[model samples]
Target: MEELDFFKSPDEFPPRRGGYGLVHVDCVGKRGYTNSALVNLYAKLGLHRYNWLEGTNFELDSIMKFNMRGAASPYYITLVACLPSSGLQQIFQVLVEEERLGILDLTCPISRPQGTESSKKESTPFLRPHSEPVSATHQDRLLGWTKSVIPWPSSEIGFSDTKRFYMLNESELQCDWISLYVELAICTSHRWFKARDLSNFELEIVQVAIESLHDKEPPSLKSKAAVIYIAYKDLAKARTGEPYHYQAVVRRVINEATGTLSIQGDCWIAAAATA
Candidate 1:
């Protein structure tokens, strides 16, 4: 694949053959995202947490703003996902993985109407295991809403595409903003950073690690896996340093003989804006 330019429109992607593999729409304000912003987020999480296939391939189909019909015209964004059926399955499986990580309610409803009977109930149905009920308080605790404020997936039915773009109608399926940014981190290609762009400091680290592990850089280091980068953003949490934000695109190498996956690695400080 050619080097990805995250600054370009994310909507520019290949077409899906199967009818709207998995569509997700959410009402959102205009919060434009850049390629570097997503790269920063991905570096923080790493590929293991945000699996390239399970999380990043979901494409942004469209972002539409529609006026409320009756009330004063307040506009909101509708984000669409167009992935292959297998991709859709992978997304759900990732949700199951998150649940295994202890957030149980992947498909919880954000809120019900005031005075709804379900709102009066003490428990909310967890979706992954299907039909398992947990107390609302415990559910909130396990999901870390009070502590970390991580966005959990909550689904709703029915959305409108007033402009008729993509020939979409009222009956189609779509995931929402939480599914895009919070659940998946809205990614495209998996290559995070190119090692050729590494700063001298970062290159030195890679070279030393490689010499210690394999006595040389792997043949595929330049071509196959050059862009796997690392970035450090939250410095106040760090034990030492001046606490300035810094980022690097790193190359991680493994010597199967050593039985270690990251025995050798290198990084390049991003020459771009760190914020």
Candidate 2:
């Protein structure tokens, strides 16, 4: 089963920072329940401690948060057993095909083995060889596809020409809990969609612009929700690069859902280039 591959890396573990982990189940109906079941199963298999609270199993979260001091290494593998067995297999087959087709070229480097001469080599390349670069036309096509798929607030949904942009699939979007992953992708490509820093007045102006444009027909429910969340979070972060304040504003806006529907931030004005 496709889920078998997730469990195949017995030594692999999750990162210390908390993030979403994809889990496939034998059946669509079992997806939610299997999350808990697998936790118990793994714990019983001596994987780690398991706890169930209010019918929610947190085994995956615990394992991902596990820290090993000194010689101990935490195991952080996330497994999902998907159902309609054939359906799961088909999804994986498509993914593998995409990888082979160069449709998905996202890859990262792995550290060399410790205590090895190769590890000591200064000029050794860590990334996979034969990696291909996406052409500008391909990037434009991808961006256009993303714009078509995700309904923006309106034509007036102004994006900074200075910022970079990126397109993420549903799975990849979900895996990026903090949104840093997406930002990294954009920065790597040297494209910008949102500015990283702005004053409170600048943030207010952007929010007001968005609110002014929001009166039009809303996008699909998913798109609308995502856009709202993204606009607010990104705006807040742009004004203040700190997470705590951004999250506080997010929580406040979320709590005052009605008022939040309307923007009440600072205003924006053009700034001159500094010498």
Candidate 3:
């Protein structure tokens, strides 16, 4: 069921950093950042290592700071997987598709190998090179996999506790998680939405936003939510760039709003009782 002619050139393909490319951001803290948030995010997704007497299965390979040069983006920590057997290719393929489909939350796209222009043009829908290695670009940093050897199953996250923004389809969705991923996508696209580049990710976010805006809640609440979402994103890029403290401050502001909501709920209840 494979397309042989599509794989034209008999020439050997160059080596790849074969494996799953699960991308995550490592928000550098005031001092040193920790990978705990990253590890916690993974663990929340029900991914853990099985340390058997015979051998280990499903382990963390590396967590490195990638070269993601974006305005509001934080340093990336790529979590590589050392599978039990050799399903690296399939895993990578699925991860790529999931990221594209917005099933998994990620800030960057999967990296392609170095290859010639002709071969790149002939690359499949999944961007797998047919002939030579796909050419590497600056965007490769977003894939979270570079050639590095590190110890597995690191605890303590990092020296400093890190914060991660991940969303897995299998888990219950978070309002903030959805907004965060959408805002990140908008930022990477330079805040411009082009239909040509719009796909499942774009469509999914738009659908959610629309539904949120049109929910049974009051119109004022919906408008306020949208305004807050936009304002937070704008503030993230204002002056300080993206820092842990900055995010913490923003989070406090958000929590204050949440607190206000609780007060409002009490007031509403009282008003109803009087009525």
Clashes of each: 10, 19, 12
Sequence-dependent TM-score of model 3: 0.20
Estimate the Cα RMSD of every predicted model relative to the unseen true structure: 22.2, 19.2, 20.7
**lDDT over C-alpha atoms for residue 154 of model 1:** 22
Candidate 2, residues 49-75, lDDT tens digits: the string is 111001122221222211111111122
Weakest 10 consecutive residues of candidate 3 by summed lDDT: 259-268
| Residues 59-159, model 1: lDDT tens digits | 43333321111111111122233454554422111111122212111221111111223211223321112221212221221222221232111223111
Off by over 4 Å in 3: 1-59, 74-79, 85-108, 111-275
Q: How do the residues 1-275 of candidate 3 rate in per-residue lDDT, one tens digit apiece?
A: 32222111222233346622323334233223433332223221211211111133444443323322223222222334455486441111011111222122232122211121222322233222123222222122123221121111123542121112111222323343343334333432233433222222321221121111123323222221211111122333234543211110011001111111100000001111234
Cα displacement (Å) at residue 245, model 3: 27
Comparing 1 and 2 on lDDT, the stronger one: 1
Error of 2 at 142 (Å): 2.4
Alpha-carbon TM-score of each model against the true structure: 0.21, 0.20, 0.20
